[model samples]
Target chain A: MRSKIVLVLLLVLYGCSFFLRGEDPKLDLGDNVMEGVFFQGGYGMQWVHDTAAEFERAHPEITAYVWGNPRAWDQTRPRFLSGNPPDVFWGIHNINFWVNLHDGLVANLDSLMEAPAYGQEGVKFRDTFFDGTLEEGQFEGHQYFLPITYAISGIWYNKGMFDEHGWTEPETWDEFLALCETIKQTGGGVAPLTHQGKYPSYFGMIWRGLVYKLGGEQLMCDMDSLVPGAWSRPEILEACRLSRQLYERDYVLPGTSSFSHTEAQMIWIQGKAAMIPCGTWLASEMKNALPEDFDMRLMSVPGFRDGKGGIGAMEASAGPAFWIPVEAANPLAGMEYLRILLSRKMAANFLSTVGSVQPIKGSTEGVNVPPATQSALDRIAAAGGETFAFQFSGWYLELENEYRNALGALLNDDITPERFAARMEAMAERLRQDPDTIRFSRSPRGDGVAAL
Target chain B: MSLQNNGRVALLFVLPAFLFYLTFLIVPYALAFGVSFVKWRGVTLNMEYTGLGNFAKMIGDPFFWKSLYNTVFFTVLTGIIVPCMALYFAVAVTRKLVAGARFFRITFFFPNLISQVAIAVLWWFALNPEFGILSNFLRLFGFTDLPSWLGEPGWARAAIVAVKVWAAVGFYMVLYVSAIEGIPEDYYDACKIDGAGEWQSFRHVTLPLLSEMMKVTGVFLLLNGFGTFDVVRIMTDGGPDRATETLATYIYENAFELGKFGYATTIAMTLFLITFSLAMLSLWIQRRDSVEY
Candidate 1:
């Protein structure tokens, strides 16, 4: 009888612990005044949280919680689907992610922008941000998210190594090829270009560069729906031919398909590879992961000819944006907090600390940006280049998988370029037919292009 | 009164275990079945009744089919190779054929004690194509080139199977060793008295006795074959053209990576079905009367 009582007591204690552990209850504020903004964990997020706390102290009623990354997006989706998302949520520019979720789960920020409290701030914020960054946040003439950071994808090289060797950055595709030859002749045993070839997404990045060189920004806009004989077009064929040439010439790392992004980055840092095609994040990662003496520099990927820029030639901007959920306990409070964050002073602080380019005007000046990055930014601004859209964005999940698979097959020589294009067309066709796939206003209307 | 009291006591003793089985196993299984039929993106509260839509999609998905094929291939290879190797080692150890038999047994079993993830990382470095020990060694033998073992189609699958077999062999060997030791020494003595050769004794007496243990091991191996995930996940991540993808990894990718809960559950149901049927078939084949000796 005593043992049974002991067992019962233990069971009761175990059950009680389950209910005891969880997030603390949200603090209550009287009369719906400023409460706080919650953020997920990231290098950028830490800055946001710190800045948020300062803003709150200046205006005592407000408070903020900086949470860890929402690793359980699957577990959290049900709450989002129920229309009760967090008061402040993170947004990504990629299609079918946080920004698109705003279509159904979030309040239309456009409506919020029209409010008197928001109107002046909204217009000022809009003017300060780069046009391309702003354009990426708009869908169907309504802004769903605010672009927070701008990233440029390009070829990063060891500047010191180039200076010592008397080698200059290549200005054209032919020049780039010649540079590879020169490096090989000069007894640099390493490949000229290193990238994460195993991931099909990396291949898509190269394709984006080539496509931009061939047709400029318009090519990306019209990629989902191609005109008749698109695959057989001379420019597209040239892109494929050039890629194959690079492979045959052994200009890319041998066993390139085996290396992960991190592995490739390490190789580049160790001076094994002359150049690596990567994003602005590489600079910050290198600073943290490499020795202090590491001397890496970023450059816009070289052009295809004398004038046309290569793919990833200009800055590619995409990043997390802050949004207010409609079902928040204090929506007005959340909006006011966002306003504080978007202020020029706060934006500059974030940009400097996080190694990011803020989308606020005057935030770029006096900021401590690396010289190479500053140069790339200046070049993109000079060329009137806009945002580079991720090619697989705005497609169904299966369609994206198909593209990744096709690219993997292409890299392994399991499929020809013609077959790769055919497979992509097929995937696009499937997405067109799938009822769940979101259709943008600009989507192609008719069967002018045959379904693959 | 005595029989009835005994029956009540048996029921009382089983009640907790029965409740646990019902809650953890039966309830979740039923929930998963219900979930498999609906079109629910894991994140969204919204769900649509799709009946067999998810299953239908699974049948047509190339990745799904590829994963299933890989899983079967891995299972068959590991099931045959690991057990045979274990049995051979078991026989050798029991006969005291080698010096430091205990050391050999403990050393071989050491890998089984290490976490699968740790072992995978160790092997990954050892097999790294450019600077890895294996590739460097191969290059020394007049072979100037070698494929990345975990990064190519044929090789990735083979490497995954090899890792699984390596990790599993030791545990199964210990089982065989125990079973072999349990056999009465008198049987071998009798075989020698009858002028039976070593091979003849092993074929007749030892083989018959170990048959039951083999049946149990076979069933376990068959089930593990279908459910394998960690080694493959850590090693190849189902890449190099999805060559090393298995049903579990595919299901994980769908549910977590892609956020297609309905599709993932459907795949899981299919895996459970296959594993269940294979286990049942194995049990049927291995069924026999308990050995009296």
Candidate 2:
């Protein structure tokens, strides 16, 4: 009897491993119970769970279940493949699972965006957010991602270092190079600028700004279109040549090329480097690591000498966007939860809890913010309406990797400008021929890269 | 009723394990083979039947060949070194010639208890450029231009192999220990009575007894070397420009990072067949050399 019982139990467990609950019993969502999966931000995961709990209170009948995972995107990959993905994707990573929208796995958020926001009277959901947030999330010319958290990327610096040294901020290519020279000469083992070396993807901030400075928007357009000779343009060669000057002149911190992002950031915060290219969240990211009076500041990438473009442009992206999967069992409830998420109260809650900006305009005006965050906002306002810019790497991951490899080679002075451009051209050409590649195009609108 | 009923009950008892094996192992292996003949990105139901197209591309991919070379190179190193070193340590512990034999046994096996990722991270710190123990030790000798153990191509592959052997030798040593302990005491006694030295006794009595365990550990290391990932990923990430990429990392990059599941599965299938055949060949050789005890 005992042998038979053990055998029966083993068979049952094996069968249960492959079991799917299938559709909810009774096939009814009128019960108002639903699940929302979100990406847990580094600061905390409780923000989303609290928001969900508040949402349930407002609509008393609805019981919203929230699951916040740091790896929510990859965790839900199998479900997305099997056609039953989680209702929502909240926080974002460099690799977004929503890029599979072309596969009809994600629901278009157009209808939700068209509706009036939960508590904002006489305003559409789309109108309440900042310009170009939703535009970045458009796929196949339809709204797919709901832009929520907004972070800007630029060169981070310590004003105290520049002030104490009597060094002036550079506004053009010549001035920037001259400043680097001055910093190198003024060094007590301090580099003029440093960057995260291990993740060469961060090269996008400086390179994007430089390309715009040299080539203008038309060159960006050509590159995005994957034009045959676009990558080898004289402007590109010049950008590569000028960028490599830092390495040649010893302006980069020794061993910076060997450091990871956090390690390099630690070096910068400790005043070992004058500047580091980083995102707006750098202050909050290094809050605990930073000295109490670090006085962090932001600067636009200096324009090229006698350049046609880039005098009034910025590098930024709408990040940590949210979206719903098409096969969500209770999408209506999930969409309603998103409406609550975008509500003013929740937006304020995100700011108070997360210490980052939201996509809504005038959202950060009255909120208590870190001094560095305030400086970043002021700098953006002072840009005189600079065009918000993105590069090929933002759209094409393969092209991004090619640029990273090329830049790492450039830093070591292993490849010249012409060779770097040619190598990149070859990689772009190969990607253009790949049948599996997805393409998105953009042009610099009044402020940001709006979908074309 | 008694004889027939007993046979029927015995078959029923084994059915559950057989079903579980067929469900988990055999089914997935068969499915992976099917997936290789398609052009699926692995996130959808739509898989275009490319029918040997992925296989054809593998022949011309230089990156694939490089990774294969790295895998085979690593397998050969670990194959020869790990077992031999393990056997040496196992003998030292069991020979009763050394003090604190129990302590040595416990100390050697400690590394295998730590997780691979944690072990990789520990090595990463120990091999750090600025403050690493190895770097500091080298610097003390007036070596200013110390090469990064994980930065340069040659050093990176060598460092990975060295770590893997260090971590793996402990587990294999335990296997050697068990076999050495199981050897009948009479053989050692007979050799002792015949005026044999330590080397002669080990050669005549101990080696032949441990042969079966040696062959088993040999096959385990060979297959594992081909399928390695955790350490390689954490240490070099197959870089200094793909210098240390193995078949496992290559497939992972293609499938997860690059979203080319179809081609990745084809490479995996190729890896499986190669290891499977090599394992069979090893078993055959061991059988031919076996002595009935």
> Per-residue lDDT tens digits of candidate 2, residues B1-293?
79999999998999999899999999999999999999877878888899989998888776789889999988999888899889999999999778899998988899999999999888877876655688899889998867656655677788888999999998998999999999888888999999998999899989988888888898999898998888888877776556678999989878876677899999999999999999999899889877545
Q: Could you give candidate 1's per-residue lDDT for residues A1-452 as a string of tens digits?
A: 99999999999999999998874445443443443333343343566676567666756755654343535344345556666555665532122453235345555567544543322343544455555455455656676666556777777887777887888877677888898887767836867777776566665666556765775544444564433344345555566666666777878776667777777778878877788878766766555667676676666655665433333356476543666666666666666666657666677777777776666767777788766567567656654553355434443566566666767667667777787777767666665676666554233212111111
Stretches > 4 Å off in candidate 2: A1-30, A91-99, A160-168, A181-187, A343-345, A409-423, A443-451, B1-10, B60-62, B91-101, B178-212, B291-293
Judge the docking of candidate 2 as incorrect, acceptable, medium or high.
acceptable
What's model 2's TM-score? 0.87
Model 1 chain A worst lDDT window (10 residues): A443-452
TM-score of each: 0.89, 0.87
Residues A1-452, candidate 2, lDDT per residue (tens digit)? 99999999999988887785466532364656767877665556666887788888878887777777777766767877888776776645435343466667778788888888877788887887877676777766688777667777778888889888988778777788898888888856678998876566565578777887788777777787688898899988888877787777878776555556777788888888899998777866676798877788778788865775657466666743678878988787778888888777777777776777777765676678666666666666776545555546656766776687667656656578888888889878877887767765655453335344
TM-score of each model's B chain?
0.94, 0.95
RMSD of 1: 4.3
- Highest lDDT against the true fold, candidate: 2
